[model samples]
Target: MHLENLITQKVKEAVEAIYDISLQSVELQPTRKEFEGDITVVVFPMLKLLKGNPAAIGNAVGEYLEREVKEVVAFNTIKGFLNLVISDTYYLNFFNGIRTDQSYGYVSGGQNEAIMVEYSSPNTNKPLHLGHIRNNLLGYSVAEILKAAGKKVYKTQIINDRGIHICKSMLAWKRFGKGETPESSGLKGDKLVGNYYVAFDRAYKDEMLELKSRGMSEEEAAREAPILKEAQELLRRWEAADPQVVALWNMMNGWVYDGFETTYKNLGVDFDRLYYESNTYLLGKDVVAEGLEKGIFYKKEDGSVWIDLTDEGLDEKIVLRSDGTAVYMTQDIGTAIQRVKDYPDITGMVYTVGNEQDYHFKVLFLILKKLGYSWAENLYHLSYGMVDLPSGKMKSREGTVVDADDLMEEMSETAGSIAAELGKLEGYTEAEKKELYHMIGMGALKYYILKVDPKKRILFNPEESVDFQGNTGPFIQYTYARIQSILRKADFDFNTNVLAEEIEGLQDKEKQLLKDLEAFPQLIQAAAAQYSPALIANYTYDLVKDFNSFYQQVPILAEPDTRLRNFRTQLSKKVGEVIASAVGLLGIQVPERM
Candidate 1:
C-alpha cells in the first residue's frame, strides 16, 4: 500500500480517538524542505467539523499518531500542519520489495477498452518537416505511455495522397522533367518530388505576374494562370480515373511512400495501420445521405450538404460541395467510422494534430455525436503547438520547411562533435562511436520536444538539448550511464535482497531517491490520464537528480560494510532500470556507457 494511504488511515484513527469526531478524509502533502519530515498532514480541514485552535488540534492528532503508528516515529506541529517522520526500516523494506521487479512502474494492459492514436498524416507531395517530427514523437510517446498505464493501443495515420497539392507536383514533373526519376537524379524520391512542387509554385507566380502586367486583375491572373489550370485539370482527370493520369499518380505517390518509410524508420516511429485519402475521400457520402433523411444535416439551396452547429456555438460547416464532392471534414468522418469498423475493440481515439485544427476537431466530434455514435464522447484532439527554429516559421510550398531527414543528420553530427570535445569515446571503435552519436542525438531531440507541455510552443536549439548538464536529455542519459558504471564495477552479485535490519539508517539523499522511486507507478497513471508526456519526462529528470546526489555523497563499491554496499548497489541498479523504462516511454534509447 502507498504510504499516503497508510498514514491517512492512521490519521483518521487518531482524530477519532482524540477529538471524538468521525473524520471523512485527510489532506497530505510532501513536507516542506525546511520541515524535517517525510510527509506532512494538513490539519486545517479538520477545523470544519471540530471547533478548536488549529495548532492545538494538530498537536493532539500528532501525539495520537506517534503513539499508535509504528511507521510514525516522530512528529512536529507547525501551526496547522502535522509533519511526521517515518522509520528508515519502512523505506528499506519498500526498496527490498521492488529491487528485483523489472516492471516496477508499468501496469499490465487490458485494464480498459483499446484506444486508436492517429498522427503524422502528412501529404504525399512533400517529405515530413519539423512540425511532423513533434506530431510523431507526441503520438508515439502517448501510445507508449498509455500502454504502460495498461490500455491497448493501435497506432495509425491517414496519408493525404490525393489532393490539389499532389496534382501540383505531378503536373510540374510532367511539364519540366526531361524524364528525370529519383534514381537518375540521385535524390530521395520525396525530395525529387518536392523540388517540382516548388517549381510549380515559382512558375505559377511568374505566369500570374505576367498576366497582371498585361492589364489583368490579380484575381483573374491567379485563376487563369496556365500552370494552375493544368494542375486543376490534372486533379479532375485523376479523379475521373483517366488511365494515363491515374497511372502517373500511382507511380509518383509510390515514390513518395518509399521515401516516407525511410524517414519514419530514421525518426524511430512506426504505425500499426495506414489510411489513404484516395480510398476514404468518398466514404462519408452515404452517411451524409442517411443524416439528411434523419434531419441531422440539411441540404442548402445550391445542393451542398451542411450541418448548422450555431446552437452549439459554432458556425455551419459544409460536408459536401454543390457538385456532390466530399470535403476534408467528410473524409475525416468516414475515416473515423471506418477505423472503428477495422478495430471494434477501440472505445476511444486521440487525434494528434496541430492547434490550427482545434476548431475542425471540435466540429468533427460534435457532428459524430449528433449522428448518434456513442464512441464520439470518448474522442480527444491532442492538439500541440508548432516547433519554431532559430531562423523562423517554415512554408512547404516554397520548399523552405526544415526536412526531417536533414535535421536528424544534423543532430547526429552535433552530438558527435560534443562527444569528441568531451573525449568520452576513448576506447570506442569508430562504428560504436557513430552509433552512440545517433543514439544520443535522437534522445536529445526527443526529450527536448517531449519535456514541454503539448500545448506550449517550442523554440528548439540542438546545441542546448545535447548539453551534458541541466534538464537536457543527455544529462539524464549520462546519469543513467554513471549508474551502469557503478553496477559494472561492483565485483559481487548485488541482486540478493538486503535484510531490513542490516542497514542502520537511511541517508537523506538515499531516502529522497526512494521517495522519488515510489512515485513512478502513480505518475504513469497520472501521465496517461492527462495525456501529458511532460509529466513522465520531468519526473524522470527529478529521479535522476536524486540518484546523482546520492551517488556523489554515498559510497557503493568503496563502502567497507558488505551489506550496506550491496544495498546501495541494488538501489543504483533499480534507479537505472526505471530511468531506462521511463525514457523508453518517450521513445529514447540510453547508452550503457557515456
Candidate 2:
C-alpha cells in the first residue's frame, strides 16, 4: 500500500486502541500549506466523545498516533485538527520503492474489461477542424487512461463517409470538369474533396436564385439541376454497388485515410479498428429486418422503419426512411449490433461523441436494451463539450471553423520562434529544432484541450502563445529538464546502498520534495477513477511547481556537504521521475526544454 494508506491505517488503529472506538473515516491529506505540517486529519468527530473540547481531543489523538505510528515523525493539535509530520524515513522508503520499479507510477494493460472508444467521426466532405482535435484528444486520453487502469482499450473511429454532403462533393467534382484526383490536385484528400463540396454549395445557391427569377417551379428547377442530378445519380450508383462508383469511392477514401493517418500520428492518437459508414449503413437493413421479426419495431405506411419507445419517454426513432434507404439512426443500430456480435464479451463500449448527440445515445441504448441485449447496459456515451474560439463558438456557417492542420502549423511555427528566442535550441541541428517545435506545439495543444473539463466548452485564446509560466505542459517539461541538469552535475553513484537512517542527514527541501513525490501513484489512480484528466493536469502542475520552488530555494550541488548534496540530488531525480510518469498519463510529450 502507498504511504497515505499506511499512515492513515496506523492512525486509525491508534484511535481505536486509545479511545476504544472504531475510527471509521479517518481522512489524512497533505497539508495545503507548509506551516500546517505534512498531513492533517480532523478530530472533531472524536471530540464529542471526549465530552467536548475539540482541541483537547485532537491533541490526545495527535500525541497518541505520533508515538505509535511509524509513518509519523511528530504531531500537534490546532483548531480541532491533528497535524502529523511525516518522518523523513517514510519519504525515503517511498522514494526507494519508486527507484526500484521503473514504471512505478503507471499501471497499464488493465484487466479484461474491454472498451471500444469511438472518436473523430468526421464527415468525409470536410477536413478535420479544431473541433475534431478536442474530440480526438479526449478519446485518445480516455483510452490511454483506461488501459493504464488495466482495461483492454479498443480505440476506434467511424468515418461519416456517405451522406448528402459526400454526394455534394461528388456532384461538384463531376460538373467542375477535367477529372482531378487528390494526386492531380496535389491536395490532401479531405481538402481536395472539401473544395468540391464548397463549389457545389456556391453553384447551388446561384442556380436557385436564377431559377426563382425565371419563375420556374421549385420542384422542376431542382430536378433539372445538373449538380443535383449528378449527385443523385452517383448516390444511386453507389447504393446499387456499381463497379466504377465503388472503385472511385475506395480510391478517394484511401487518400483521405492516408491524410488522416498523418494527422493522427502527429496528435499521438491511433485506433485499433475503424468502421466506415459505407459498410455499416448496409448492415442496418438487416438489423431493421431482425427488429421487425422480433416485434421490437413497427413500420410506417411509406415503407419506413422505426422503433417505438414512447413509454420509455424517448421519441420513436426512424431507422430507415421511405424508399428503403437508411438514415443516420439506421446505421448506428446496425453498427452497434454488429460490434456486439463481433465481440460478445466486450464488457463496455464508450462513445466519445459531442453533447449535441446526447439524446441520440440515450435513445440508442434504450433500444438496444429493449432488444433483449443485457450487455447494452454496459454501453456508455461520454458526451464532451464544444471547443469554442476566444471570439465565439465555432460555426461552420459563419466560416469560423479552425482547420486542424493550419492550427498545428501556426502552433509549431510559434514554438520554433519561442525556442529561438529562448536560445534553448542552440545545440540542436535544424532538423532537431523542427522536431522539437512540433513536439512542444502539439503537447501544448493537447494539454490545453485536455486540461479543461470535457463537459465545459473551452476558449482557446492562448493558442500558439500558451504560457509555460503556470499550469501548462511546458512547465512540467521544464521541471524534467531541471532534474536532468541536476543528474548531469551529480557525481555520486545512485546504485550505492543508502539506508533510511542516512536520509535523516538530508536537507529539509529534500525531505519535503520526496514526500510530495510519493503521491504520484495515488494521483494517477484518482485521475483514472474519476475519468477526469483535469485532475492529472492539476496534479502535474502542483508537483512541478512545488519541485521548482524547492529547487530554486535549495541548492542541489552547491552544498560542500557531500552526503547532504548526494541525498538531495537523489531526491530531485525521484521528483523528476514522478513528474515524467504523471505527465505521460495524459499522452503529452515533455520536451527537455521549454
Candidate 3:
C-alpha cells in the first residue's frame, strides 16, 4: 500500500484510542516544499469531535503515528497541518518493486462494459482537413487513454457517403472533364474528386448569376440553377437505385475511399468498424412507424414524421420528409440503434463531432432514451471547438481549406529546416535523418494539439509548435534522448536489479523524483475519467521537468559509492521507460538519439 493509505488507517485508530472518539474520514495532501515531510494530515476536521486545542490534537496524532506506524519516522505540526516525514527505505522499496516492470502504469485489460468512440466522420465530397485532424487526434488519443485505464474500447466512425453534396462532385467530374482518374491524373483520388467538387460550386455560381441577370430574384436564381437541378435529379436517381447512377456513385465513392485510407494511414488513426449513410438512411423508417403507433410521434397532412419535444425545451424535429425521404436525424437514429444491435455489450458511446452539432447530439440522446434504450443514459458528445489557422477559417467548397496531407508535409519540412540550422543530425545517414525529421514533426503536431483542452478553440501555428524547447513534444523527446545517452555512456550494467537493502542516503531530488513517479497509475485513471488527453500531456511535461532537475542536481555515473551509482542509474532508466509509455498513450514516438 501507498504511504498515505497506511497513514490514514493509523490516524483512524490513533484518534479512537487517544481521544476516545471514532473519526470517519481522514484528509491528506502533499506536504509543502518549504516543509520537510512527504505527507500532511489536516487536523482541523477533527475539531468538532475533540473540542480542544488544534496544536495539542496534532501533537497527540503525531506521537501516535511515530510510535505505531513504521512509515512515519518523524513529524512536525504547523497550526492545523501535521507534516510527517517518511523513511528513505520506504521510497527505496517502492522503486525496487516497480523498476523491472515495463508495463508499470498500464493495465492490460478491463472487465468494465465496452465503450465505442466515434471520430473522423468525414464527408465523401472532399478530402480531410484541419478540423478533421483535431477530431481524429482527440478521438484516437482518448481511446488509447481509456484502454490504458482498463476500459474496453472500440474505435469507429460513420461515413457520410450518400447525399446531394456527393452528387455535386459526381456531376462535376462527369461534365467538366473528358476523362480523368487518380491513376491517369497522377493525383490522390480524394484530391481529384475534391477538385471537381470545387468546380461544381463555380459552375453553379455562374448559372445563378446568369439567372439573376435575366431579372430573376436571387432566391429564385439559386433554386432554379440548372447545375443544382441536375445534382438534385442525380440524388433522386441514386435514391431510386437506378443502375447507371448507382454504378457511377460506387465508382466515385470507391476512389474517395481509397484516398481516405491513405490519409488515415498517414494520420495514424483507425476504426474497428465503419457505418455508411447509404446503408443506414432507411433504418429508422420502421422505427418511426413503430413510434407513431405507440403515440411517440405525429404525422403531418403532407406525410412527414416528426417528434414534438416542446415539453423537453426543444423544437419539433422532423425525422422523415413529406416525400418519404429520410433526413440526417432519421439516419442518425437508425445508426445508433444499429450499433447497439451489432455490439450488445456496448454500454455507452462517445460521438466526437464539432461543437456546431452539440444540440443535435443532445436531441439524439434524448430520443433514444424516450425510445426505451437504457444504454442511452451513458452516451456522451465529445464536442470540440473548430480549429483556425493564422489566416482564418477554412471553406472546403472554395478550396481554401488546409489539406491534411499538405499540412503534414509542411510540418515535416519545418522540422527538417530547424534541425538543419541546429546541425543536430551529424553522423546519421540521409534515410535515418529523414525518418527522424518526420517523427519529430509529427510528434510536435500531435502534442501541440492534444495538449489543449478539447472545448477550447485553437489558433494553430506550425512554426510555434515545432520548437525544441519549452512545453513542446520535441523538448520532452530530446530529454528522453539525453537519458538514453547517459545509459549508453555508462560502462557498468545499469540494467542490473536495484536492491532496496543496498540503497541509502537518499537526496531531496531523488525523493521528489520517486514521488512524481509514484503518481503515474493514478494519473492515467484520472485522465480517462475526464476524457482529456491534455491531462496526460501536461503530466508528462511535469515528469520530464522532475527528471531533468534530478539529473542536474544529483550524481549518477561519477559517484564514488557503487550502490548509490547503481540505484541512480536504475532510477533514470525507469523515468525514461515512463516517458516512452506516456508519449505512446498520445500516439507519439520518442527517439533514442536526437
Largest lDDT belongs to which candidate? 1
Clashing pairs in 2: 110-150, 110-151, 111-150
Number of backbone collisions per candidate: 0, 3, 0
lDDT of 2 by residue, 1-594 (tens): 766677678767776777777766776777757465788887766554546677877777777777777677787777877788877776776676666567776676655677788889888877788889988888888877777667777789889887667777776776783688877878887777767777887787678768877888887777676667777888888888889877777766676777787777777888888888877877768877888999998899988888888988888889878788787777787888888777665777888899999999998888878778777888888788888777777655323468788888888887777767777766788888888888778777877888888889888854433556677776677678878877887776755546688644545666667766676667766766667778777777777877888888987788676666766677777677767766676778766654
Instruction: Judge candidate 2 against the unseen true structure and give its global Cα lDDT, from 0 to 1.
Output: 0.76
How high is the lDDT of residue 303 in model 2? 84
Worst 10 residues of 3 by lDDT: 496-505
Over 4 Å off in model 3, which ranges? 3-29, 32-35, 40-67, 75-84, 299-303, 310-313
The C-alpha TM-scores of every prediction are 0.96, 0.89, 0.93
Write model 1 residue lDDT over 480-558, tens digit each, in one string: 9999998889889887789889888888988998888888998999999999999999999999988888988898899
Query: Which has the greatest TM-score?
Result: 1
Point out the higher-scoring one by TM-score: 1 or 3: 1
Listed per candidate, the RMSD to the true structure in angstroms reads 2.0, 3.4, 2.6
lDDT of each: 0.92, 0.76, 0.90
lDDT of 2 at 152: 78
